[model samples]
Target: MEQAFGLVHHGTATVGGRSGITANTICCDVCIVGAGPAGLAAALRLADLGRDICVVAPLPGDGNRRWESLTPGAWKILDALGLGTALAQSHCLLSHAASVSWGDREVNRDGHAEVTFLIDRARFDACLMDAARRRGVRLLTPAVASRPQKIGDAWLLPVTTDQTTVSLCAAHVIDASGRKALTGSRRHRLSPATLALCARWRGPPAPPGVTRIEATAESWCWSASLADGAHYAAVFVDPRSLRAARDEPATAFLAAVGRSSPRWDGTLASPVTACDASASRIARAPGLEDTIAAGEAALSLDPLSSQGIQRALVDGQQSAIVVNTLIVHPERRRIAVAFHAERQAEASRRDSAMCHGLYREQATTYQSPFWSRYCGQDTPVEHQLRSPVPLDNLLPETRLRLSPRARLEDTAVIDGDLIALAPALVHPELDRPVAFLAGRSIGSLLARAFSGASAASLFDGWRADSLPEGTALELLRWFWQRGLLVDSSATDAS
Candidate 1:
């Protein structure tokens, strides 16, 4: 390895099978911070392009496990990079519709949709790192990087480890450090809108279809059987809710779940062995400079979107394309701008629609006094109807107008009084509920309920009555009327 890089080791020590010397510094074309999905993906892409790439991440034995979502496209990228086998063996596929219920009625009014995968984040990340190593990407573990400094035409990075402090220089630096850490100008720091609480369980395999059920007062919670033979469930709640539960105990949280949705009964009864949680949201101003951000660093998606992993994979691929293009043709910076703009527009549309629905639901439930005050029935429809603002617009001042109870920081929302308004404004696109039943006809509304009643008990009260073929078509028509799904028949004919 030293010979390939034309380096001489000073001592009789070996590292990653290479006899190394005393030098602690290194240099490469690209220095990627954070070894999570985004960083690993970037390194692999650069390596494939034959560029020298160096990746720094917290060491494997460092005992800090990162959390991540693994989508279908992300899995495909891993397969292309020769890590698919490892991922397939270590992650869980979520193959069912998710919903929320106040009583017997489903909050999301839709029927059924596509599913995503839930992964054992630590194992999955390790697989990606290993794949990068096999492809000649230099790997540095147990390292923490300070804010990157721009020096002349290159980037200077200082990293600290147990042994010593090391400095490396690179042409460009990619910030994939996620939300906990970031580099570049602090122009666009937005407070987080919500806090999430997650936990894992060991139980019987989840039913064929995995569903995530969320309530208004309680945070978004999900459960799925993992590929590694374990069950997992997590809740994303308001910080106030977490605080309230902190003193009460597990039963209080579980009781909150029971009030929101019937699905929690099974999980509440199961023995929970592990709990993991965090708060997340997009950067408000993402600043201006030659540097670009991707994944959580670029924009944090609501976990309810279930598109977290999909967005990361897409961002990684698109960012690589943008970087390579800029390297070869410095004049076409517009290409990168256009790329980011298109994505921004798409994300804006989705965020606005989802937040609107969530807010409306909260208003209806009157889950807590906090929610009731901000989402009071008398709140103006215009405020509720306001276009889903880009995360940038959801700043402290803006959020205050939406909800008077929130506390905002430069980068995180320390208090979540305002986020209560999020449920009121959640978009209809996101709130629509879906279910999958294996039958041919729409039977009696009650009978349909019985066909799949057993499973319905697992989720909210979803019944599996058969629908007449024509009725099924009408249901699709209703969904189209509501703007949930597109009618592509015309486009297909064209």
Candidate 2:
């Protein structure tokens, strides 16, 4: 079987004939729109499977610019695509925890979370494009795929660019055009309480040991030092508080933050850069005939959870799997439909709960029109506005454990009674034992025991007293670092 892919550049041609341009023509088994991480990932994965893939995107230019932050999962996906090391060297790894404070109470606290990265969107997109090119995926830049048409069982895409128009035929089309280019009538609108403004800045070296500091009032303010010593800060505000600053954007938002906490004073400086902030709900149609949507085009979640990047990668990878399956089996289209439906439902549940919770929390403190509209003195109003579903309901079902499930005894005999038992465990009464008499790392021991080697054979020559004092602790730490072990209480059980 053969496949083809195409990428149309953004802003190269107006699809509505405003630019007096004709459509270009091409043919491929699969045509992917958008060249961001998701689209590029789909292209690369499909190409690796020996399918014809075409990637379309806007030509490298100043008009099509984007700036956003990527969470930890983004790095993982990039690495999987062979760009991880380069991105790690270039982007700033956010190491600090994120705190949300309101009044005297801290509503939320995330600790030791290192899954976020702040990056320049242009550079990141370029990197993906280069990777896709090197992997044999066809690329079409400075091109735009206009209204899609149905021709028998296939789809015909009319693409346009500055100098020419082209027609591309494909059995399937994946839309990664994002929200701005969505062709569906259904729309996801964010709550009025959600708003964000961000900009880049060059400032004095960030205060040592300070990675990110956030303050919450009617909204929240986040400040962090980039890898290059530059600082980037964003203020998320409610619509009401934002209106109060109609005449002065940065000043009003900064003042709101300053009034909530004095710490922001040091971070908010003159010549502060700013950008307009907007929020939207997540919405999508599972599959429109032969056309499928992925990435931001299919669904958008609240940025509060910082799950945007992760979801994009997941969607990209899942979409690739779906397309490949459909190409091979042809009869399993229903499975792909069901998969997307489940994804949309989960995204909707999560986005709604997150935005509502944030809006309500802020509303309780600030007595502004925005807060009042969303959250007021009415107990029923507040309670009714509460999230319909719990946050845990959004997590995907995976086999990875957050904590070790098995317990090791001080000493126990293995198969055949060939191994001897000893009970010299210190602090045996505590939930976590400080030391084990066994002279070996528990993880290493577990690895050996699970490797088809009998416990007796492996431990027969082991010397309990020869083990170092911190060997077990070191092993546990290693397990934690590798995500092989989890703290039971870190996540909700259900």
Candidate 3:
């Protein structure tokens, strides 16, 4: 039998019910919820690892008609998943740079630096789902999976499809459900809460792969020509700011685009859609270690970053590796879970910080309440608003241990130029935290040793076997907060 969706499938089931793929009550190695890129890519990856996979999702994904731009980095991840070349050959618009208008400055960013593609999310997701189905992954659609319940070391998910219910039992479950995690995950919006009002347009022939971004006194706007030959424009605004626009969402969004740039003038059209564009993350919780949340289900990136889709593709692959490894080496389950958590958290923090930094650059010129809020400044009425990064989450007395899941490498640091230690889980964005650790070189020591050594002991060791000082402890706390270090006592490895 051919693997569905062009996936490289292994031979058929050698174990009864293990490789089972059907609609009725089924048993499988893994059951994945959500069939977007992350979830579908994961299903393909896990199937390659020889795991029987079942995916439940609504096809077409709301026709996700808004134009989505894909970066070169995102393609690398898809290439590894066998979708990159297919996507490249599919209906897509290719461009090299974006027109960015921030504050009073407008320029073409990274002109000729990278190949970016503008795609329709619906077609993109459909392509991925088709790939997963061909790869031996059982496709269950129009089926809504209820919250998974852990039963006797397996997950029992009740899937409802076409007025029929199927009980699926799998050893592992992956929640790729966007924003509100389907596996009962909780999300806290990190950035100033904002909504995106979007509309599809047909006029003057949309630019080929060129994405336009403009920042105004009240909010920001983005416009791009999708592969479908439709131009899409979206306006992002704080609810209060959108209210100040004094009109309905579609009207306000059109008004925002009207003055956003010369290219977007009078080109707005109908079939508008709006969604929450706020940066959010799954809260650090106990049972989170039991399952993995990939893509938006784990952490939602900032639109201003221009790397959200890239991050999701990479995240989807990384999550699959972690899950596959854990299933093979059950003994390293703790380390694998820690790896997923820390990397996801680090990514979330960096995305938030980067967006704040970008906003700060524009705040100098605009200084409106909306821009001011993003810059960590507050109006009289918005007194509690502050920078998105909550660095105080880590406590001094917390008992931390080297995460067995961290990747070790010799990397440059801000403090000492270069150091041999495990760098921040997310590079470039959270490198400073590791640079601070390089000042003490604690990461180097931890790399050489650490069989679950306590953070306090590590600090004492940093202090030459004497009482721990506050500076090293503070730096280590950054690692703990970012997932490089895990709580020694909280994790019940036994």
Best by the lDDT measure: 3
> In terms of TM-score, which candidate is stronger, 2 or 3?
3
lDDT of candidate model 1 versus the reference = 0.52
All candidates' lDDT scores? 0.52, 0.56, 0.68
Off by over 4 Å in 3: 1-24, 59-64, 109-111, 203-206, 226-229, 243-246, 284-289, 377-494
Q: Per-residue lDDT for 1-494 in model 3, tens only?
A: 11222332233422233444333455678888888778887888888878889888853445337677777777777887787767765576777768888877778865665677777777677788877877888887867888876666777677777756767677888888788687654577677888888887776665467788888887898878665666787789887756675678777776767656567766556756778898888753465458788889888888888788777776776677777866776776665666667667767766676677678889998888888877673311212222332446444455665555565454422221111234533332244334334444445556523566555566667677442577666656556555566666665351
What is model 1's C-alpha RMSD? 16.8
User: Where is model 1 poorest over a 10-residue stretch in terms of lDDT?
Assistant: 413-422
Expressed as tens digits, the lDDT of each residue in 1-494 for candidate 2 is: 01133343333333322342333445577889888767887888788878898877855543313345676666777787677766655444554545456534664435565546666677777777877888888888867777566666566677676666766667777777776544444665544435665544455565322344354445566656655565566666665554665646666655655665554544543344444344343344434555667777777666556677677776776677677766876776775656565665566565556656666766666666655554442222121222222323222222223234444445321211112233322221222322232444443445443343322333332324354436544443343343333333356442
TM-score of 3: 0.71
The candidate, 1 or 3, that scores higher on TM-score is: 3
Rank ordering of all candidates by lDDT, starting from the highest: 3, 2, 1
User: Which scores better on lDDT, 1 or 2?
Assistant: 2
